[model samples]
Target: MFKEIIFKEDAINKPEKGRLPTSIAVLCGVTILALCTLLVGALISTQRHSEGLQQVVSSMLNKSGVENPVTAVLLNFRSYDTLLEIAVLLIVAIVMLPQATVSKSLSLIRVQQSADPGLIMSSLLRFLAPTLIIMGGYMLWTGAYSPGGAFQAGALIAGAGILIFTNVQYQVNMQSFAFRALLSIGLCIFILSGFAVALQTGQFLEYPQKYASAIILFIETAATVSIATTLLLLYLAVAGTQEEFNHDA
Candidate 1:
């Protein structure tokens, strides 16, 4: 009798175990199907709207105060969108960074001391880093007339920073005042510029025709620095966490 009751209980629990997984699989399939339907609808709508996009671009370009259509679209016609995008990146960086604790200390420490990039990589970084800096600046400057902007320039600068971090022997303290300031500087400058413009023209981010180019250049330069610093800090945060984990183990 006891054995029969135990077997019956096992059988009942077996189905319950399977039910959870089955339900989860069904839920996932339904969710995916719904997402696919939404994506298709969005694509169809975009296709329908494609014809008028050029006309809209042309209409906005004249009042945008920039020669490059892309630049004008990003910095003048749709600047609020750009501001929100930067804020998103900044927020992500802030969220991903580890919180400070009383135990945390600032000091020069070696990263991946046992797994150095070796003499060849270290030597290459010396020449490569400066070149990337120059390229990044060039890209920032050319963004006014050509196919480059703050993002591209910032990426190049971040690449250079990564190389330096990996090849060199010092660890950066993300909590440092200067480092924190650099991380937020771009967004700060962008906001201040927007307010300044608003005060002058009674419209947010609406650059006066005479000062439009200068204002855009200033914003881009600050954005590049902010982007580079933020990216480098993100890299450091990941690496630092991993190193701490390994050390604890």
Candidate 2:
């Protein structure tokens, strides 16, 4: 007649895994507020100074030897900053460029994954690859007077290189001095030219007004080469370094 009944005690509410403790949440909120304040201050400062900067750039545009204000700033007025950028890329490339494995070909890059494209697709890629390189060259050449520049040229060229790489026939020799030279040429030329200018004018990278155009062209050319190769090397380091990867590992 007696049915055994089990009484269940009330369970304590558990804090959610996704929710932070109140103290931590408050701390994070305070940190975010501080960052927002700093960012707002920085924006205000930049806004206040930008008007003067634009006027200065406008006045000096002709002297910078480029029709494009952006290119003038990047490759002439503030070239050191661009040099530093390329140097950083060079460092990244050096870090990312893989050494040839014993089992792979004596090249820095190896095609770990193979693909057999249809004739039409293959022909299209081949056509596009060379076309991209030509476009990159045009971009580099036009940077002095137009909107394009070394970075744009490098990106376009890197795209072509990736297309070629994916065709499963690439075996780049990273161990070659020529390959490294191409990867570092931008930074090397930048530093050397800056020092050369300094030796003549007592200020590094202060290009003479007479030769500014030629110098900018030279630097951009070198930068395009290095930037493109470095970018490709970085992509290879990411995609080509492992067999399980979908690329040159």
Candidate 3:
């Protein structure tokens, strides 16, 4: 009698397959409201004076020294915003790494039978990774005078790290004390340097005189390493392996 009662209770609690009528009605209402809002916004933005805003933006972008105006606006004129953006990104990465279980240990194991890549693919990826890394560094170095900046360099560095992660099987000390220290070091440097700049020049992130280039370079290099490691770790956490993958050239 107890077993039958339990079974009946379980059946009662089980969800039905189709959407509830109330849910369907709510979804339809939301969709209709969203469409109405979008239409209204579109009409409002198309007013006669809108082109004036466009012209002003064009004039400002043209005056910016960097070649790519969007890049200039993002990394130079709006740098404080960019700094907060990067800090948020770093926080999100740290939060995403799983630690509730010993799942990270599983990532240290190889699943596929290891086979050496043929001469062509191996040579190709080897050459490509370094080339991209160098190009990324160059981009960061010239960012103040040219189009590219830390974001672009960091992206390329992460791509190279991905290549290295895939092309070699090795144990990573993801949870090591040293690794944690290294992970936080980049943010520390960025914040400390910004504060120093503020103290010396009364402007946050004002590259100090005679060391401006060096400061930017240091920040970019650290950013590259931090972003690369974080991305590689995230991939390992998700895909579950420290084994060399053959996804690259």
Give me the candidate number with maximum lDDT.
2
Candidate 1 per-residue lDDT, tens place, 1-249, comes to 022333764575542322346677799889999999999998988745455577888776766666677888888888899888889889988987776631334443335466566789878887999999999999999998889999999999999988887664545556556666777888899999999999999998888988888898999899999899888878877776435533432
- TM-scores for all candidates? 0.73, 0.73, 0.62
lDDT of 2 by residue, 99-200 (tens): 544333344555533556557757978789889999999998888777899999999999888777656555565656677889989999989999887877
Measured by TM-score, the strongest candidate is 2
lDDT of 3 by residue, 1-249 (tens): 022233664586664454457877799899999999999999999866656444654566544444455555554456577667767767866886656333333333233336565677568677998898999888777775667877778778777766655654433445545555555666777778888878887998765555654665676567666666666667766765422222320
Give the 10-residue window scoring lowest on summed lDDT in candidate 1: 101-110
**In model 1, what are the clashing residue pairs, if there are any?**
none
lDDT agreement of model 2 with the native: 0.80
Summed backbone clashes in each candidate are: 0, 3, 1
Q: Which stretches of model 1 miss by more than 4 angstroms?
A: 1-50, 101-117, 241-249
Ranking by lDDT: 2, 1, 3
Give the total clashing residue pairs for model 1.
Answer: 0
Q: Which sequence of candidate numbers ranks them by TM-score, best first? A: 2, 1, 3
Q: Determine which window of 10 residues in candidate 2 has minimal summed lDDT.
A: 240-249
